[model samples]
Target: MAMSRNLTLLFYVTLLLIVLTTNQAESLSSQLSQPQSQSGHSMYGATQGSLNPQACGPRCTMRCSATAYKKPCLFFCNKCCAKCLCVPPGTFGNKQLCPCYNNWKTKRGGPKCP
Candidate 1:
């Protein structure tokens, strides 16, 4: 009888552990699936990010390297990357990889992502 009682207690403990584990996993996965907000960059304006933001600095630096207008190029490239979360390959063309970067324009209808 005592062994049976111990077994039942162990079973309840195991079930509780399983329930807690499942709930924690579900919570983590839901957080992962949810989009996170970016803060402290309103000066660049609001745009949707579709790629890993951690990679933006290197990608933007590469994109802006060849330009004589490094400051504005870096600024805009980082801005576009923050919004589109993508940067075209190489220091030149290949904007086709990111349509958001490719199609964004200036106030007078110039390419905004450059």
Candidate 2:
């Protein structure tokens, strides 16, 4: 009788573990399938005024570098100047350091300067 009780207990424990694992996997799958929000937009890295001609430019031909991690503006200043402008994630073009090409700049390995 004791052997039968031990077997039943083990069986119940195994079933509980399986159920827990299955539920965990389902939760993970659902989370992965859900869409992410970017700048209050429903697409990755998309924002309002992203396609505005005035913000981008009338005839801007500036292209982003292949290795640039952030989105490049369509009208960034060329490398010949000391001060340039950068387009922040959620807003339009904003003034920034010339050669750095980022909204924030760093000096001597310190924190970024806005």
Candidate 3:
């Protein structure tokens, strides 16, 4: 009877270990797959390259603006006129002009530039 009990306890322990290990693996995988955040935008990583232009959000428009200090700046436009401009995270720019861009670079590995 004692031997049986011991064997049963060992079985339960093995089962518990398997369950714990599986749970841990799943959690780790989920973390790896999840997108990192940068300047209120999702940042996959440096290896993933720049974010798509469409992903930049509705208020912003990314283009090669002559008025922008940076070659490519996120322009806030209203109809025909551009109200504001901001550089991407990886690119360099001033605090006043590229607030979001600066934030993205500091937080994420690279800017959400397209």
Candidate 4:
């Protein structure tokens, strides 16, 4: 009886480990299969691939006008715009149009875009 109980416990533990490991592997594979950028856009290719151009205009305009850092600004703006779908107007000091964009944060927890 003691031996049987020990065997049953071991079997259950082994089964549980297998199930947990399989779940973890599936999760990791799903994450790997999807290509994403820090700015929350799917990294399809160059030129902000697969984004709707219409939604990018406001953020692009704002970022273009606000920063001397053209390349990085554009990249950040496009990413924010892709997610938020709207950009606050003017060169600086207005973010009411898209609350989500305005509130976005970088990985380091700072403001994501200008």
Best by TM-score: 1
lDDT of 1 by residue, 25-88 (tens): 9988865653444753321212234457887888788888999999999999989898898777
TM-score, structure 4 vs. true:
0.47
Kindly list the per-residue Cα lDDT of model 2 for residues 1-114, writing each as its tens digit: 999999999999999999999999998776555444654432321222233334333212233332242223332322211132222332323323212434334466632412
| lDDT at residue 99 of model 2 (Cα atoms) | 21
lDDT of 2 at 105: 40
Over 4 Å off in model 4, which ranges? 1-52, 55-59
Worst 10 residues of 4 by lDDT: 42-51
lDDT of each: 0.77, 0.39, 0.43, 0.67
- The lDDT of model 2 is 0.39
Measured over all alpha carbons after superposition, the RMSD of each candidate to the real structure, in angstroms, is 10.1, 12.2, 11.8, 11.0
Q: List the residue pairs that clash in candidate 1.
A: none
Error of 2 at 81 (Å): 49
Error of 1 at 16 (Å): 20
- lDDT string for model 4 (10-95, tens) is 99999999999999999887666655679755432222223466757654765587577878777887788777655555666466
Comparing 3 with 4 on TM-score, the higher-scoring candidate is 4
For TM-score, candidate 1 versus 3, the one ahead is 1
| Candidate 3 residue spans exceeding 4 A from truth | 37-114
- As a TM-score, model 2 comes out at 0.33
Clashes per candidate, residues 3 or more apart or on different chains? 0, 3, 1, 0
